[model samples]
Target: MLCTDCLALRDQVAIYENELDMLHEEHQTQQLTDIQQLKGVKNPRRSGTGQLGSLRADRHVFISDSGAKGTIESLVEPSDGVATVTVEFPTPDVTPTILGIKEYYCQLEESLQFEFKATSAVSLGDHKVAELAKGPKVAVTDASKVTDVGELKNLIAELQRELADLEKCGEELEVEIEERKEVYLEEIAELQVRRPCGDSQSPPAIGWTCVCSCVTLCCVEELENAQADLDTQMKEQCADYDELLSEKMALDIEIAAYRDLVELEEDRLCYL
Candidate 1:
């Protein structure tokens, strides 16, 4: 019933629609591929440094330049395959516990103690390093030779300020930990008073037991979270400290070079 020109135009329109659908499908597929590629780039499984990937949990991972094996305690993977791995080695003073405690309260206490020790050690080490570096202040014999002596002084002053800030942060962290410990102790004592035993069918008593368990779990998790935060803080502080040390060494070298230049200038002026 349709004219030849009309039928031909209808077929052409259908072909164009099919082509568009195919193009759309291809576009969607390409978009998906791009998304996957971006994710892979963000969280690379294999190290760009040519480190081999392993699926075995017990396999030793090398973390240092010397290729020393460290037992991977845990791996936190916030993004797909990429992880922040915590590697630990067996030491005489501190050994990782292979077996976990069944009791919730005991586990919480143990976690708290472990975090406390780690935080203490890092703080103490930082303090000692800071003290050692502070001594024998950079004495510029010919301060006039260094044109940017004021800048160098400012840099050193900034380092001192950073150290003070770090000390303050550590004190704050300790105070927070102490406060948390007190709160935990109070909760534990309250739980002890309300400790339910013997098969009680009462709904209220059962609910109370659940609450105690939840509280215990929350305490344990909170301590773990605090430990993680402390670890992050320690890394940041260490980086800052290293930067300060590097700057100090560079400044010392620059000062020495300038002093030599000044001496050369003096000799030339005397000759003239």
Candidate 2:
């Protein structure tokens, strides 16, 4: 027969175990949802795979601004919702150039001209990062992929480096976008203020109003289109960031489990 204190401790332990089980179930469900999202079910922006959907290494691209032709060396996905493409030109004298993903269009015969360009958008916040850290473990790297613990550690280190780069890129892009937006906004305001008022003596005020209205309509349409494109790009970047974060979290969990297994094996050996 257990004492009252002993019975109380047992009850507490049972309750704790039940709570843990519920948490585990919730985690599994979240993982399923995340996997489905990564598969592009929830994100219509994700098309194809491998870095911004078809912007993979070795793809030929043309820099529209400079008219320089080159093969894609790599695509750096931005944290601030922009994509940067590194291109290697055939001319040895010409150093490999990095351009905004929008600056270049894919030259693939099957691929349509990609109109999407990276713009300034929301920055991934610390709170969001913390929330993602609690998400279910995703199997980013298979256990069989690494033959030894050393190899696994190396892979994790590489991933950490990539994650750091992405975070830095996001910060820089955010600042740049804000500055560009401000400058453009100022210019637009100045243009509006400087517009010549229709002279009552020459052109009728009504005719001037009509001309101004047409110009305003065109400008409004252009701005609307630009804003829509920016929103789409932002969504795409957020999805990419989430997918990468999930992968990193999964790898971290895998390493932790591996360590636990090793420790358990060591304890069994000691008892033997």
Candidate 3:
């Protein structure tokens, strides 16, 4: 087919894609609003009833019974004189969300067909803050033996070191994200320049097969260029929007990771 026809067809396709993208984005905004509400839910449990709500403090058992009835005072060791007895906390079934926050965002995105190809990069960073976080990595911090000035000083020093390191890492990530954004903007500009067409470009100045009057041809050419320019701008703007959306998702994942860390620390506490 002629370039004229091909260009027209491409323009038509661009128009359809633009409309599709707009509707998809609107729908996604609405979905995000709903998810935000769910995330902010003050309490998932009823005020009076106890039907497994998140607000209720779970059972914290202080006794264990492997061979005898579970009680606060039960022999946890064998009758043999050589073995010493140990008291264990009662275990309560704690079920975490089978899906991580990042996964939840992904699932939410997938539920919408229009945002089909939203594959964002994933990042896993190590802050080694488990000690300061009172996580499983540093159970020694939980010991009650450290009461002297020297012991307390050492623990405080360790905690301060870990906190400073974590803060430094966070600053580094912020710098990295800023650099990434600079690169992203440059790429978007390049794409705009090379994109197929834009709104500034208009239809052909002449007829499909024949050259019309100079004035008429020029007029048509002006409109065609205007349309092309507009199209390019629209596409580039959409690209930037999508990138920002992905960045937002990445941030939410970090927040969720912190929440998970909290839950993990609580697990260790229950053990203690």
Give the per-residue lDDT digits (tens) of candidate 1, residues 123-192.
4444321221212222222322333647657655665665566566656656766787687678767866
The candidate scoring highest on lDDT is 1
> Candidate 1's error at 15, in angstroms?
76
Locate the minimum summed-lDDT window of 10 residues in model 1: 93-102
What does candidate 2's lDDT look like per residue over 120-147, in tens digits? Answer: 2445445321112212222245423344
TM-score of 2: 0.29
Q: Which is the winner by lDDT between candidate 1 and candidate 2?
A: 1
Clashes of 2: 0
- What does the lDDT read for residue 233 in candidate 2? 41
Model 1 accuracy (lDDT, Cα) = 0.48
Question: Distance (Å) between predicted and true CA of 251, model 3?
Answer: 3.5
- Candidate 3 has a TM-score of 0.28
Tens-digit lDDT string for candidate 3 (144-185): 233344555565556555445544544554565466556655
Per-model C-alpha RMSD: 37.3, 36.2, 31.8
Residue 236 error for model 2, in Å? 1.0
